[model samples]
Target chain A: MSDIVFTNVARNFRRDGKEFPALRDINLSVRDKEFLAIVGPSGCGKTTCLRMAAGLEFPTSGTVAVGGVRVTRPGPDRAVVFQQFALFPWKTVAENIGFGLVANGVAAAERARRVADVLKLMNLAGYESAFPHQLSGGMQQRVAIARAYVLDPQVLLMDEPFGALDAQTRVVMQEELVRLARVNPRTVLFITHAVEEAVYLADRVVVMSRRPGTIREIIDVASVRAADSWDRFEKIEDVMDQASFVHLRTHIWRLLREQQAPDDH
Target chain B: MSRRTVVGIATLLAVAGLWYLLTAATGWVGSARFPNPAEFGTAVKQIVTGGYAGARIHEHVLQSCKLVAMGFLVAVSVGLPLGLLMGWNRRAEALINPVFLIIRPIPPLAWIPLAIVWLGLGDGAKIMVIFFAAFVPSVINTHAGIRNIEPFLIEAARMLGVRGPRFVFGVLLPAAAPLIFTGLRLSLQASWTTLVAAELVGALLGLGYVLNAAAQDIFPAMILTGMVFVALSGAASTWLLGRLEQRVTRWRTA
Candidate 1:
């Protein structure tokens, strides 16, 4: 079971010789093939939580296990898609996607085949040789997502991957994401501040509290999808319009809003 | 040609015409102070055929270019890797930075006396001075380039399981390359200028040596000829470097 288990996780950041907690007691068990979106207000340490799963970070005091193995450093088992669409600027679209395969010592012919297949899967067939700067924000993020997915990792950690795109592009990406997840499911920890996004795509939504973040609420969004999956609504707009979607989105929004610091209000 | 190139060419032609009117055509500036194109042409022919000091004009140009190439290549070989080490490892930076801080403030010309004392008045001393000139920028800019990179890119690579030497070679080197090239360009300019100044006091051959001899002899035409060759050679090296930089970083939008 390619599950991610975060046991009593806490993390602190030091700035100017001052120590401040960023997350505390983040106990999340993201099940295999589950789409778990962690939603909260900005500075809620949602991204930090995702980074720990990617093995790019460590908790000050807890065990983060991927497929039952304790994460110490980044390994081939997990892939991350960052909010900045951090594609290697020197590498082409195809090169970026195949970077993991290369790192794994996958031979050239096989690497090309898998990269080409994933390119088609992501609807990025014709833009292989193009650079990241040449592509629009949506297309660049698609490449980033494609890069992570091509790894065939046990877990995919995304830190607000769609947060940089325009509203229209973000919705379209969400739709594409839903379609892809249905076909090739993997345990995914997606972090976002968008309530509709957290509600529209996740099987379960974990709402986080303000800094020194904690799991304020764990929401089951898939109940409304008794027989039909969220992918049933071909368009993100259609999913956003569902009565159940609106209720869940509003509930998560209210939960997140309450967690915002009082001083800010 | 594009509008920009065409406009640039026209501006150069306009300046040349103004120079011609001032010295060659009107004789208003006086040829003694500023040689006419014809007088400059005569000087160029004399240097080309008769030779200057101990060598021909082309030989002097070749010598200067060789000195620059030697100094620049050595600096790049040593400085590039040193910069990478410092940029990649904090411990390396801590170890190297103090010495680098002490060495960095001294001008390349300041080393002339020491270079002569250590290596003597020859190609070796001149090369040493030029090496110091090129070395500083190569290190500083390379370090800056690596530090300036977005930290997220490193996270992305690490997540993809790229670390250790692979991370340094595959990720850091390429990411910092454009800025490294920027440093190389500065180093190139430094090498040229430093070589000239060093050669002025110590060299038997080179453009600077030619210029020094010309000034002493009060041969305005030869001085003009020497200055033109120096400018021409500097432009040539910079142009070649620009092409290489473009090819390496072609992924960037112009």
Candidate 2:
């Protein structure tokens, strides 16, 4: 069964007394424990799709349902990892990770236990007291992911979570993410502009067309990465070297490049 | 001492040495208008050991501090919450901002007459004047502080089930604290300035009272000493607040 279902979703934002469509007729469903990546150019509403699922924004014309209930607003059952990390500056890594549990009124002792578990899972144990600014970009993103994981949400929504990191850091983070998914599997809807990242991480990649974005194609990552033995390519370079990886990357690039920009003239 | 501290002390001494050379050593300006370093020392000693304007040096400092504290505490307690609500809610801003704008631009000293009429020339009148001086900036800075908090942080808080009172305390306040402290510092400095003005208009004891009395008596040494006290107190309070800011916001990067 699907964990998240979007039914004919359309969103329009009113600006200067005019309704501008952000997403239109978008229908998608994320299966339980599936890793789905949505890729498109900027302004294609890929992030909007993730935000809708997170219940941060509601579609103007359609419904977004999580675990069979219609989403009205954000809830603890679903968590988001923002592009900027969104870790509270005043809070240490551990406090930021435990913020949700504290807000949910988890007892302090239980909060500490769960926070400790996630810290060890994300390899953030010793850095608990370090503030976000004290950490490197990669480490901060790990804290962000750990924060989401600490809540044990049924679905995770990430909006370019690694978009801010340097390329070298991005590669390491990408490998860590897949490692994280293997240990703590959940329904994930990841949004990104990097086609290679989509091909690298996602079970299936959803390509979106420009402006008032709609899904153009859904490409299943090929046999090499899709096989049960895909774990054999544990290293990112090894995964990149696979012939199927290059083919899927080229395919998504062409699909994205072929889409025309919406004509306003 | 650290190099930075050593350099800072050296700079202060050099400035004082230059002042001594200009006034006491060369006697370029007469002691009538400009008191020499030796005279300044004597005036301070006299004030400390004896008294100034019928009140000792410590009494003048204490009185001025009390007036500032009264006005400052009230302004912050009222202004910060009011400004936060004003910035957070569109309706609150629309309703109260116009009256605030009208009151804010009028100089605090300009309220001396109105305060005298309403509250009389007691401590009440002086505090009222200082209140206006501190209140305007307190409100403005608090408003800006709340408004300047990143929108993403608020969204993150909401997603974590932090809303209403919890949202304000857990997220908004801490996130806005660095800026709020800045507002507090500015409000405090403003209060100190208006303290002098308030005492100059009416009061029996304060550094400002001492300065006015010394000016009228044409004792330049006494005036200079009073000026030094005021400058030193202002610097000291600001430094104290800076230290407090550092202690509270250890998470913030310099």
Tell me candidate 1's interface RMSD.
1.6
Top-TM-score candidate index: 1
> Which runs in model 1 stand beyond 4 Å of their true positions?
A227-231
DockQ of all candidates, in order?
A: 0.74, 0.64
Per-residue error for A77 in candidate 2, Å, reads 1.6
Candidate 2 structure quality by residue, lDDT tens digits, B138-191: 899888888998888888888888787888888887888877888889899999
lDDT of 1 at B108: 95
**What i-RMS does every model get?**
1.6, 1.6
Count of steric clashes across candidates, in order: 0, 0
Q: Best lDDT goes to which candidate?
A: 1
List model 2 lDDT by residue over A56-79, tens digit each: 888998899988988889877888
Per-residue lDDT for B42 in model 2? 94
lDDT of 1 by residue, B35-112 (tens): 988898999999999997778988999999999999999999999999988887899999999999999999999999
Model 1 - which docking category?
medium
Q: What is the C-alpha lDDT of each candidate?
A: 0.90, 0.89
